[model samples]
Target: MATPVLPRSVQRLIDEFARLPGIGPKSASRLTFYLLRATDNQALDLSVALQELKERTRLCSVCFNITEDDPCPICEDEARDAHLVCVVEEPLDVLAIERSRAYGGRYHVLHGAISPVEGIGPEDLRVTELVQRVAQGQFTEIILATNPTLEGESTALYLQRRLAEYGVRMTRLARGLPVGGDLEYTDEITLGRALEGRQEV
Candidate 1:
């Protein structure tokens, strides 16, 4: 015998919540019910926040990081070393690095790594823009601060080859970061040490 169907509205909310990463059916049901019982103002606030997040947030034209501003505060900050750029896989990685307070260089967010399994390539990333930026400006160094995963290593190597003609010093993060861990989840102390001990690629 088939299970009885839930009310369509409740089922729809559960389905939406279940689609989120790491949210199982049970958790989705809990969240949907919680939201249903929440104050109308609270739920409306969340809905309005989500709408504004989509409307107010945009990719920074220069670094490709998600920001409310075009250049982003980091890119616009004259105090940062423009000649030394740290290239990361995503905006979350940028936050991880910033939390360490170990770097004072500008950054270039690739938005994602080159993953063959996912059918993502260098062309899918902000690689061409980085190359053009290097061509336009005489940068001294570039750090391939992508994660230590196989896909990250592949992306780093691809960038290395592509930027060979630039003659700019390229470096990779040290082993302080766990081999298979993501930068966004790394502790600040370990991330700081990795930045401090970064080595030539």
Candidate 2:
């Protein structure tokens, strides 16, 4: 018996699948075969959507969120409270908070947190932009909604100390958030409660 040879096209698909997070080589091979058995339109649609995602999306200039527009809809929203800026670790965090329907303020997405092991420092995030915004003295309160994990806590603490001289009210999310959990994974009800119970930094 001889081993079956995968075509170059199939091998390319497997490579792409492997590039996705959490998709090991075995899983990638499985996905490639799954797609091969799927309808042609399904695969085409997936490809088109992936292409459009990169072509149509860009970082929001104001909040640094992934959006179709430069400023993002949230940054341009007049109904939200401009005096309050909820700072979070990622764009997904913004979505999570928005889903709660409890926060009515604007947002600033940090993109990442400070992690020494990961070689991610404050310079690698949107921290400088946040400092500039605070220097403008336009916001009255900054809600540090970063996750409750060690890295998240460290990032929040660093921001607190750095912005302390800005004279604006600084706050942190309430302590009831599950320890070591990502904000994006938390339930809206729990997130809402945490927001409501936010305390001064």
Candidate 3:
């Protein structure tokens, strides 16, 4: 069999693209070719934007959400209800809830849910930080907005037990969402109704 004749730079770009989720070798090649045909300024702008994303972004210390500053805008905003905290599996999930505009509480990003098969346990997540936050007794309500998947349910149950000592009211999102669907994909209207109709877990 003859060896492929791709240039080193082209091969490298293909490999990098393949590493991204949902991008296969064929799509990667298409993207690389598209970028090659794009104006130099377009590629340069994309490169600069990617560089600045990592360089300028930081995790908010309070909510653990991605932000340019230590405390995220939601955490810093006085108008938000500090007495309630919404717990989600990822930073994107926080954005999802925010888009609904029904939740006025602060948020805690767990980063990941409890995936036993994937070796992701409670210790692997931001559970300790949540415990500390609950101990502070600042929040009276904690809404477990983790997805409606098995791992998400397990995480919420675990948190419910762990946080019981804090005396803060605990609730979970209404289960009208399709099981195993990512919260990030749910529309704002559905998510808003889910939040509003949340029940004690």
Error of 3 at 124 (Å): 1.2
Q: What TM-score goes with each of the models?
A: 0.84, 0.84, 0.86
User: Candidate 2 on 1-201: residue-level lDDT in tens?
Assistant: 977598889999899999999999999999899889999999899999999999999998888989998789999999999999999999889889989899999999999999999999999999999999999989999999999778999999999999999999999877658779999999887798888887889
Give a tens-digit lDDT track for model 1, residues 154-198: 999999999999889999877688779999999887899889888
Q: lDDT of all the models against the reference?
A: 0.92, 0.92, 0.91
Per-model tally of clashing residue pairs: 0, 0, 0
Of candidates 3 and 1, the better by TM-score: 3
TM-score computed on alpha carbons, candidate 3: 0.86
**lDDT of the structure predicted as candidate 1:** 0.92
Best by the TM-score measure: 3
